[model samples]
Target: MHIKPIKTEADHRAALARIDELWEAEPNTPEGDELEVLVTLVDAYEETHFPIDVPDPIEAIRFRMEQQGLEDKDLVAFLGQRSRVTEVMNRKRGLSITMIRKLHEGLKIPLECLVKEYQLVK
Candidate 1:
């Protein structure tokens, strides 16, 4: 098993191809070990070169609300009042730190996701 650090795009591609070839490798075998190491290297390379942005805070909230089958009115418990929930959902108001904490605690949303900056409408 020839393994190396995934340092460049070409190296990343080659590692990916090898991982695909070893996709069905049985655990505790040489091929499986290679696959695991290549996956870790590819993940590290992607994290550095193709970092993903956190979702917009409002969008994350909306997505969670949808997943929970919740309505705007349901957000009052986390966001405060009906009007505030409307303002937040409409991007007419920015989320305060307190509100972010409440949303994170009450909805099980990640603090990072809830605290991401988003545009406010005029």
Candidate 2:
């Protein structure tokens, strides 16, 4: 096995190809051991080089609303009255714990994404 740290795009590509070849390698075998090491190296390289930023909290809420075919009225059940929903959506009001929990549970939005503090326009 000739494994190395994936330092460059070329190295990442090579590691990916090797991983594909070793996809079916049996565990505890030589090829399997190499596969595990290569996978770790590839993951590390991707985490550093291709990191994905979390979506904006309001954007995430809007996206989930669209995906679920939800309307303002639907949000009233989660957030409060229609006006409050509008306030929250428009960044005029902050999300309460109850609203956050509802969004997290009913919309399947990640709690971390929902809990992030966003700027409220004055």
Candidate 3:
């Protein structure tokens, strides 16, 4: 169990390779523990060096809609009337606090994903 902190791309790659080797290691054993720690180290390194941007608010809504097999009309309850739904989905309108809360609660979309800053057509 010679685990090392992943500080560079080389270290990250090595950790990933080790994780692959230990993928089937029995849990709670030495190899399994090493795999778990290496995964955490690699994840932290990637998060900082390869940070992922948050999805646009409208995109998040559309993704959630797709996941739930929903269409524009389905969002009318959370977004208001049919026209409002179209406007929001079309990026013609910004999502208000009320709409954010409703979407988060009703569609099970993460609040962090829904609250991301997004441009709206003037």
Structural similarity to truth (TM-score) of each candidate: 0.89, 0.76, 0.95
Q: What is the lDDT for 110 in model 1?
A: 92
RMSD of each: 1.5, 2.5, 1.0
Of models 1 and 3, which has the larger lDDT?
1
Model 1: C-alpha RMSD to truth? 1.5
Single out the weakest 10-residue window by summed lDDT for candidate 2: 52-61
Task: Give the per-residue lDDT digits (tens) of candidate 3, residues 1-122.
Answer: 89878888899889888999999999899998998898889889999999998798888888888888999999989999999999998899999999999999999888898888888887
Give the residue spans of candidate 2 off by over 4 A: 20-37
Question: Candidate 3: where is the Cα deviation over 4 Å?
Answer: none
User: Which prediction has the highest lDDT against the true structure?
Assistant: 1
lDDT of 1 by residue, 27-104 (tens): 889998998998999999999999998899999999999999999999998889999999999999999989998898
lDDT of all predictions: 0.92, 0.90, 0.90
Where model 1 places Cα greater than 4 Å from the true spot, the runs are: none
Model number with the top TM-score: 3
